[model samples]
Target: MSRLTERLHRMLHADDRLDREMAAEWEEAPAGKPASLPPEEVNPDTPAEQPDWWISVPFRQGRGLRRLLVVLSVLLCVGIITVLVITAQYLPHFGQAGNPANNEVSRRYIENGMEETGAVNIVAGMILDYRAFDTLGESNVLFTAVCAVMLLLRVSADKRRSAAYQLELETDDRMYEPKNDLILRSIARLLIPCILLLGMYIILNGHLSPGGGFSGGAVMGAGLILMLNAYGFRRMERFFTIRLFRAVTVCALSFYALSKAYSFFTGANHLPSVITPGTPGMIFSAGLIPYLNISVGLVVCCTIYSLYTLFRKGDL
Candidate 1:
């Protein structure tokens, strides 16, 4: 009975133990050897491949290292939980006056924002002027996301021309096509211009009013989407293609980065900057803020429209 039990155990665990032994034997064996030789016979001249010594040691010792790792991981989690509990005890009550968030930064931004950045919208001034790089990063992130989606979903021209691909496209079109619905086309004709105008207004008046680049861009993207839906890809492609998307996006990002770099360099060095805040309430006031807002809006608009087109039909 003992012998049978031992044999069953060996059979069940044969893979793990045999693989380890085989690996060890293979590592110690010479190149092109029929069988593993004594270590003394191993060639001194030939470079030996490194073996997984850590795993080999633990496995030979019967899961000791795995159990140890599990214990350590548990201990580490417990330690982290304990530390968090201790830290929480020291935190001030919610909404306390002494809270760290109630700082001078907010006060300064509110008090001297319009004079400093020439933006009537304090939030716009802070984000565009004071935290410009963060906004730039966000724009880059959106661009990156679109690029990733394109990589995954975009169909090549060669594939697009294939019979199988054309059939698939026909199927998709049949499912999603509006079939020249006069009502939708009429509504789109009336609404697209208004939506686009509203988006432009929001972008242009970002510094003077509530709207900014991100919001305006989203509105414009929606207009583009509506237009695409009303008309077909053939009509849309005549104006907006992948080439235009690439050019516009690159130019907007480059202009944004360069302008911000110049501003940062002049300001940091205490040198006179050519860009002035201008009269605060004017449309062209806030120096580079409006321009930056325009750049951001363009990027956001392009990104949104491109993503929609690519996701819907795998091209822009």
Candidate 2:
């Protein structure tokens, strides 16, 4: 019995020693940071040392691109600046001293449309009949911008959290939610509808007056933004689905393109339209011109609203 006990004791002691040696080895291993470091020692790895001059130098070198580009850019800028300066200098003389392009376009739209299409508004005539293609291009641009903005929005919180743990990334700030204010919200609610209605009116009247589709659409979009701030994202989502906006955009662009192609192919470009560009000064009618302006206004308003929603909400 005594001999058996002695053997057992030796086995236990050996196991204990092995455990202790392993623990010591682990503690002494050359790994991560020590408990302390000398204050005088500096960390060599820092963002400040990694100079970004390589990236910056490329931009500097780009300044010496083909002379043609420089000349063209300068000429373009000068032309625009010259127009703005001259406009600022003599806007009062706009009607008295007319530009050939402006006069020709205006005269063709107002005079010819009434004579041919019987449209009352010159601006409407220009957009709907003469420049539908341009409106379509502009609408596509807005749609593209909306998509890009949405794509850049931050990922979901769960995704962000997963990334932080897996890749050691810091948390990104979430979009802000405004504090509740009953009074402000009420005011917004009251004002938003009026603003939207006004925009619609502007769009509708574009053929008859100074305002056009772009202006009207932009105004309505602003109203939508205001409503989002005042009410909430959910409400906006419920009311204005992206699908609806996409449908409207596609339809408008399609109609514009197809109509323009038809007009061009059929050589109806100068042919008289069904609608009379009513007497030059009348507010009652403009031919297809007013309709085109309304379409553009709708497209612009939808685009602006869609963009605002994408940035603010981040979810598709």
lDDT score for candidate 1 against the true structure: 0.86
State in Å the error of residue 194, model 2.
0.6
**Across residues 1-316, which tens digit of lDDT does each residue of candidate 1 receive?**
9976875575456447765766788877897886543343234363222121222333444455667988999999999999999999999899989899899988999999999999999889999998999999999999999999998889777667655566666677556755678999999999999999999999999999999999999999999999988998889899899999999899999999999999999999999999999999999899899999999999999999999998888888
Steric clash count of candidate 1? 0
Q: How does residue 260 of candidate 1 score in lDDT? A: 96
Q: What lDDT does each candidate get? A: 0.86, 0.66
Top lDDT prediction, candidate number: 1
Per-model TM-score, in order, reads 0.69, 0.56
Error of 2 at 61 (Å): 33
- Highest TM-score, which number? 1
